[model samples]
Target chain A: MTTHPHMALVLSRICARFADEERHDLSVLRDVTFSVRTGSFVSIIGPSGAGKSTLMRVILGMMLPTSGEVVRNFSRPAMVFQNYALFPWLSALDNVAFGLRMSSVPKQERERVAREKLKEVGLLHLENHYPAQLSGGQRQRVGLARALAIQPDFLIMDEPFSNLDTITAEELKADLLKIWRAYGITILMVNHLIPDAIELSDQIILMGAHPGHVEKVVAIDLPRPRDTRGALFFQDVDALTEEIRKIS
Target chain B: MIRSVTHPQAGPWHRIHLMRHRRALILMTIVIGIAVLFGISGYFSGVAWPTLLEAVLRTTYRLALAYGIALVLGVTIALLVGWSPFIDFFFPFFDILQNIPSFALFPLFIYFFGFTDQMIILFATSSIVWPILFAVLTAIKGAHKDLNDAATIFGATGFRRVSFYLAPLALPAVLTGSIVGIAIGWEAIIGAEIIANIAGFGAFIKNVDISGIDASAVAGALAILVIVFVINRLVWAPLLLESSRRYAE
Candidate 1:
């Protein structure tokens, strides 16, 4: 019903339901409404059974909402998964070039572009390795590089750092911020990590379960390169933590 | 141009190539040496070397032709149905067809092609096609849903999906199915030849002198075994190794 300028995406009264055992309708998402501004970083954080992943699928157009409307002003969206979905049969370079290959780009051109992306991700040395041969951090980097190769207007991530070690996850988070700034791309991510959501997001959308719907949207007014150890950072984290606890 | 791929350090690719060539040469020498000994002895424990080799060549030709037909037919049918919406509906129908006795249908083949090589080859093809079809069909049906989603999201669609994603995904199954099909094909081809008295290794063995318990039959069996071993070593083993390494999830 309402609109905003430079809106990358606007979901209006979105609802999703699936058939459970006994063929009965089980609602997962209910009338979820939100708008993402272009080039802003947004995070959706919720507890278990809050339909976070289901909403992600709906947003990516991988699954249709049972009833609702999604208005998209941006095209060429890409997704990064928690499990890096690299093809086991392809080398890292080929994996990164997969989208270009599908677009019918010539082999030489795609490989050159893919190599540049790999170099950007600090993975030029491992371009010849298969996904199975790489460590988890390295594999996710390849996945990130693959998504980046398509020159997407928006990036969707579903718990991208949940599978890695603490150190690796932290490193990737900083790299992702740099990537986001450099590419000037919009990001929509879903996760249960409250502190992480506070640290990286321009806006954090909180959701409640039992037919998931938005609880609140909190805007981070802090300056760029937010200092997590500072007083204001922890205050925001504490307030968001309280909000999440109340809904969860 | 695409950059040439090479490991940072020196690899064993050259050494492995050299070893394979050496092994093949040694096996060839042994096979030829056996024929020479048979020729010089004027009559060895086996049949005359020339007749044995001739029969082998004939049978190999027939089997190769039959297998070629089976491969093309089986892969085509499986892929056509496997990726279709009607795959589940067609599966049971294919199952019933596969259960029919291949030998019982030989009279029908004989009627169509007479007692010629066509009849035997067709009969062999019938027996070989089942393993390949079922293997590929099951593989496509049982693949992880995520892989299909990934393929679609990355821009593989329509014919491109079939060619680039589905075909490569089903390759390991194809190799396994072909191996099984070849084994079945050999039995069908050899049996059909012996029964119909065709000009192949089977018939050659059937007509040889058996007063000394058939020297030529023993020789033909040994020769066939050697051929099967060499083919497996030179073709199937390497292919299998490569498939498992490259296609594994």
Candidate 2:
């Protein structure tokens, strides 16, 4: 892999809080800090309500941090939402081309590039099909294509495969790794499945609830296409599972 | 002994048989046939064809005017209420206003606007606004979170996001609302013209009533019905069906 000198994104002492008059304070994130190197694939794993999604919102600038800073090197950072978020009214091709249109790319070139990106994700045949017509896996693939077509330097994905069936999720995970390797874009993904994080990521940041914070950061030395049957893989998964258990 | 066995046949004929239910089709045909019969009877009964035709045209012009104004006002208000919390707090006022019968304001409108075109337009607008505004607000509130996130992440902000993402996503709901609004506008325009003595279909219908020509008023009403039906079939129905096909889950 080619090395780049600059880091892709840096989150320093980030904090998020939600307040409602009817309820007590909801502090989803506190003092969360991390840095993703250029072209690195980082995964965040936690049980439910660990602020994994909150962290992603902060990174995407959808939720502003109450304190600290999030510095991104990229002008545009694309995100794959957990729900796939494809526009119901638009076809898969139009969904992928949305960013291109926003940037005022020429109509013909945008269509051409969007077509190429959809083809890359094995969705060229479904270009004219709207999101409502697609299966769950197909919709997520379209979402991935949309993020990819933007040619973003950083890709933030929030629980992208959690809604899929196990087999389809695995297939999509493998596809994601292949795309990540081919394009060399920086990826930061959140996952509840420990094995998924181990298989797809270079590093895993485990989060704990009760005013959510990072509890552990483990560097996975295991190679790509990681074997779940392997001893080290099971060890890491078990350890992370135990850590999550303690928090809950 | 040889035994003959029969299996259920599965073929295009069988499928057609399964799809062709008699009772529902018969019922629908009967209702439509009755309506057409009444329409034809009304057409043949000494109705002044040219006069009613002119009145129908005038009514269409008034509908166009009222609908155009309501579209702009309703959509703008809905967007404001959807996006801003401050505006949303005032939504109750809108609800109360919508409940106030638009026809009840006819006297007030005539008093202020002096029984002119302006009174008719104002009445039509008042009747049309509520449905379109509510439809748009509901749509905006119910928008999918993922699409909104995608728009933001893609740098779709301000006017661009409103035009591309919000507008297209809310289009089906807006169309549905506009249809209701147009229907209301039609009723209001006719009623206002009758009460206010405007130069339109309702005034013509009142004149026919005064002349004891019941058939002409009926014919004029029938003409309006036919025009509405054609617009629904040719314009709104096809668009709605297409949108539902493309967007409905």
Candidate 3:
């Protein structure tokens, strides 16, 4: 046990279960334990059915684990879902300002902060547009803007770039790192690509299927602004890929 | 660097705006045409203008009261019976209740309410509420799960959740249902009046039929058509357009 409160969030042997139509209990996650260090980028990497999304929900406190505990040291944790989840009825500005309104922030301040966040994500011009009017990339940016506008101590992203094209995803990944470094906020991202986890995270939590559990946690000691196409990056990517393949 | 600025003139909003203006113009023309027709029919049918006006006002009152009550109760019931296992049990009962023809229960209402306006209003409300309730129910049930998750994550709870998320999601459904409800309300109220011989448009039409069809009856028919057109144009049409513009699939 550490004396300092260094972890932003902690999951102690979390397990989630669901009952089917037949009332038979099905395990979705099992004995998943992890600690997210404050102000660091961590990625949860695994294949399909690895309970990655379920893990995110548990950490976000949206869903309760069956047998384990989740401790969030910070309040106001925000999430960007794989589908972006922008409200179709709301304008981009309104969507971004939603969390502030929920917090009962003054309207003017909410608009100002929402606009700033949108500008940060380079979506300032689309403030009046609805999600239906936006491209997939633009929609994800709006989701990012919305999450960031809350000024949360913790930001959880569930496959944020999964719906975008390759170029948009690459650009988004770069923008995300830039924001992470600029804000110095703790981020826990769930991603399917092992190379992406190695590229963006300070630590990668590899998860395995069969009632999904944490398999391994690998640290990336690479320097900031690391080149994705560089030799060191490739080696780390290859090693992590092989390890993930073995476990998953 | 100079660039060609091409702002598309055919965006959804633009198209809706144009459509609304055109619809309004057409509605106004129809209203004017109906007024002209009413005048012609009144002159030839020998129906006094004052009597016709009284009949119109009375029917309008009943329709407004019934439709208003249905609007409030339908949405209220829908919100109360929102997506849950309750729907599985509650909806089937609601379906059966709606199918038990309004006319079939007219005698029961007349016995209890004594052929008063209250009886007519209640009967009309029963007929009007089902469409709105079911439409809202379907919308609520079919709302995207991702949107629900996002709302929860953002700390939207209780009233705020309903206002911010559920209401807007269900708006199109509400408008569509309201249109159908109004139409059914018109039918039910008119039928109730004819059966009960209440002092309204239906009674006037029944009295005209007994006395013999004249130009006055034709004028009254024209007046009914005008009322339907005006309500659609002034109320339901705009609401439908607005809802579709914002929330349609």
Candidate 4:
């Protein structure tokens, strides 16, 4: 790894709260503080309604925290939304080029970079197809290509593979790891799938919620291409599963 | 060497299939057949075709003018009402206005505009504006949240947002509303011309009634039918098809 001393992102005492229909206070996230190192792969995992999504939204600037600060070193970070928010009217190529064009990248360069990024995601052939014309897996690939084309120093994803079928999701996760290794991008991803989080992340932050809080942070010491059926893999899964159950 | 020229395969056969579903064509043919049958029977019965033709021409001109005025007023009002959130608070008031029979205002219009072409145009425009405005507002409000969010995220704010995202999404609804408005306009113009004795198809029918000339009245009605058919085929039908194709998911 290329040595970078500074942290890529920092969250200082972040808190997010919402009001219920009865007008009572509801805290989604409380006093959460963490920092992602440069070129680190971090996964946030929790059960349903555990503020995993809220954390992602707060980081993306989509939702403002009730209190605390989020600081970043990057100029513009790219996000892969949970729903794969590809513009319906735009074709795959145009969707991938959207942010570049917004930043006033010349048209030819934008297209060239978009094509190259899409080719990385194995979606170059679908350049002319609209979101509606593509399957769910294809649309997600385009979404990844869009985030990748920006060539951001940091990549943020929210349940990026939650919608895909099993086989496609596995293939995509492997592809993502390969790309992550090649680019050395700092990634913070949210996932509900334990195996996926374990397979891809260098560290997993396990969260729980009555009012959401981080329960544990586990570091994966295993090397790349960790086997799901291996003894160590099952042991880790079993321990994580028990911890998640206790929190619920 | 003698070569027989073969025409290149004319577009797709699906287009021919779509043409067969043209309701305007079918409606026109039915109307024309009825008109020709009536004319032939009237001619044999010694009804003067020249007088009938004159009355039909007068009626056609009146309907055309009234429809033109209605079109302008309806489209303008629809755009305004659809875009303004503050103005939308008065929609129920407009709804009440729509329920008021436009013919009920004929006496007031004649008293003010004095049975002139302007009076007829006023009546037609009043009849046309409400439905179009309501339809456009509904369409704008009903636009998908995802598309709106995407537009906002992409920095499609201000006038560009309205022109690009709002306008295209609202187009299909606008077309539907306009078609309904135009149909109402046709009914209003004819009724206003008849009641107010304006120089229009309705007035021609009134004159035919007073003179006891059944053939001329029939001919005037036929002319109105043909004109409406032509307008629907030439303008509204194509617009509806185009809007549906462009905006449909």
Candidate 5:
């Protein structure tokens, strides 16, 4: 049971297994346990075989866990993918409105909400453009807008800024922080950059490979508007990097 | 990268509509040019313009009916086979069925529909359907995993997935497949007409070309070539350009 008050999500002894070509079970995740605090930003950092992506899918109920339990306090959850998997045939506006469209919302209402989300992401002027017509960073913003269009209380993101250049990524990070604060939603993200997690997260969950499991959960108490160049920020980044190296 | 290339005045969607209008104008000019050329040829060669025009219309109508039937039937079957859990079982079986010599089925169709327009139409449909079916099947098989996941996440499950995701995904394939199918349909319809002694362009030509390869045959060939070129310019090419722009990733 979660002793922490206001827990948004909880995973108890979660494990995932896939059958190999030879009909043998290959364990991918084992005994993974974690709880995400309500309205908090939590980041998962780990090595290649750490099954971070699998865990996220399991949490989203896209993939079934072989064993263990998931308790989600929030009803509406949305994900921002690493690849910005917008439907190529749809314009940015239609892509943002896709969820409401699927649920049979009236066209006018869905478009109104989609436009609002796009405006929030600063992509309202480019909403009619197709995914191929948008740059990488713009596409990611469109993706963020799409996830937000559903008015989700729980936000799940998988390396959402990995494909971006430094300047674009930094700008997006600032927007994300502002949106997080305004929405007061809980966010669970999978990322590799140590300094990024330290800057944006309240707690970081570190996982290890070879039957992936949680190694440690480090709490970040850094002040808001983090100074990346400061000694304390570098100290946390160095400590996190060292911990991951040990697991690797 | 965040602010890359935003069109302040007009987006690509606007440009595409403009391009379509230009394509329509160009197609009209080509049609006029072909008509004038054919008129001069008819004036000199003592060609039976009325009879040839009737034959062309009859052949075109038959081919159009055949293509319509084939398109709907082909795409539906392709979706079923491609998305089925038994794709591995059905796909190879379908491949073997498509390999059967096309003309070999004419006798079977004739047995059912006889030496009439129905026989010719059915024969052409059989030939046209294979390319559309196989093309769509290949497209569905090779679609990206990420797109599939995205569609599911956004609630495109059950029959909704067919219309919202798979159909559009198979659109470019449908265009290419129809082009190939129409070419094969021409051969099938002509051959069936000639063998069955039915009244179409094929019969019209065979009646006039008794001495083999005369001015009538050349005029017939030229007319057919012009029709093919016009269809390519007005229909397939424009759609191809639009599909590439709309669906490219």
Candidate 6:
């Protein structure tokens, strides 16, 4: 029941459950409480079935929490889905412009802004390619561009890089960081990769499942442009990984 | 996996337009050419060309009317059946309804509508409606969950959701279903004409010299083939290709 002036989003004791097909009670999320700070990058990291995605759905208002409240002080929140979710029928440019169109932006302005966002995401040249024609990394870039084109107050990512290969994932992480820094937009992401959560986030909300709830909140106070190869960075990552493992 | 054959540097919209128009143009040309050939052969065949033409035209109009009714009603009914949980209980009834032979109802329909074009059109519609309805139902049932989520998240609701998301997603199924429906419609329309001894292609075929099947009857059959070819090319082929390019997985 507390609110901070600088808070972008606040989740107060949120709970979500759904009945199975056979009408069996199944609790997916329970008693989850957290706040995302303005312009901060936060990662919700946990093992699969830890309600990471369910928590996201609750925040996005895609699914109603069985109980509790989510308070948002921001406007125009957009999500980048795990599987890219780009319309297969639309080319990259049209896909990126989709949100703008939904918001009733004029066609000319929508395309211009979409192209600019595509450029920012390093996919301007591939804007004419359909999602089916793009590589995994390229498709994710389109997804990111689409989310950014809406000029959201905050961005939600559901395992944004989990679909890519190792090299592509790394490249995308750097690109995401660049975009986040440049835009200064608040980001709340769900990731199962412990190292990624440690590396990219300003704060990590570690979670545990079986009726999923928050386990611990760990702050990654590491300096920006973090050197992942450095021993201190590795030490921090290892510690965070161990903490997550112990909780899960 | 499903790249269009366009110039490497072509803009996406430009390519889309080009591909659409190009396929449409090709199909139109084929249809026109077939119609012209049929016209030339009919002129030389020395058959009662005027009566044959009248019957063909009559059958075309009737079939078109019946198909139109079926398309509108089929899509509407299919969407209604697929749309909500309340309607879901009626699906088992629909399952049984679709399996019932539409042709078997012709005699019963004659009793109701009494040997008129109304009966024939209704009979043809019965034959046409089921395939489209079933195809759309299957499409709705198998629609991608992610796409549904995306549409909901993007604020496509009510009519907007139906027009933009559900209709487009169900398009491939719609096209395939229409093809089947139209084919069945052609059969039903002709059979109705013959059985009812109505004024159409089936009547033309039935009344022809029965000694060994006259050249005029052969010409009539060829004309029907030409119509089918034209429809397949101009209507179904272009749609099928477009669906493969945009809608199909």
* DockQ of every predicted complex: 0.50, 0.63, 0.59, 0.21, 0.62, 0.38
The runs of at least 3 residues in candidate 1 whose Cα sits more than 4 Å from the true structure, single-residue gaps closed, are A1-5, A20-26, A47-49, A207-216, A238-248, B1-46, B204-214
- Each model's lDDT comes to 0.85, 0.83, 0.85, 0.75, 0.88, 0.83
Considering only N, C-alpha and C atoms within 3 Å, which residue pairs clash in candidate 3?
Answer: B45-B215
Model 6's DockQ score: 0.38
Better of 2 and 5 by TM-score: 5
Taking all chains together, the TM-score of candidate 4 against the true structure is 0.72
Candidate 3's TM-score reads: 0.88
Deviation in angstroms for A225 in model 4? 3.4
Model 5 stretches with alpha carbons more than 4 Å out: A1-5, A20-25, B1-46, B80-89
Q: How well docked is model 1, in DockQ terms?
A: 0.50
Which portions of model 6 show Cα errors greater than 4 Å? B1-50, B77-93, B207-221
TM-score, B chain alone, candidates in order:
0.82, 0.79, 0.86, 0.79, 0.83, 0.80
Interface RMSD of each: 1.5, 1.3, 1.8, 3.6, 1.2, 2.1
Per-residue lDDT tens digits for candidate 5, residues A1-248, read 44545888999999999987999988999999999999999999998999988898898788999999888888778888889889888999999999888889999999999999999999999999999889999999999998898888899988998999999999999999999999999999999898899999999999999788999999999998889999999999999999988988
Name the weakest run of 10 consecutive residues (lDDT summed) in model 3 chain A. A1-10
Tens-place lDDT digits, model 2, residues B1-249: 987574323435445544543443565467567657876766446777787888889888988888989999999888766666564576778888899999788889888888788778877998998999989888887777766778888867777877887778778988999999999999999988888778889999999999988777766766786788668767886687568767756
RMSD of every prediction: 5.1, 5.8, 3.4, 7.0, 4.1, 5.3
Q: Which tens-of-lDDT digit does each residue in B66-171 have in candidate 3?
A: 8889988998888767734486678788888889888998899989999899999999998989999999988888777778889989978777877777777778
TM-scores for all candidates? Answer: 0.84, 0.87, 0.88, 0.72, 0.87, 0.84
Tell me the lDDT of model 6 at B106: 84
What TM-score should be assigned to candidate 6? 0.84
Give the distance in Å from residue A72's predicted Cα in candidate 5 to where it truly belongs. 2.6
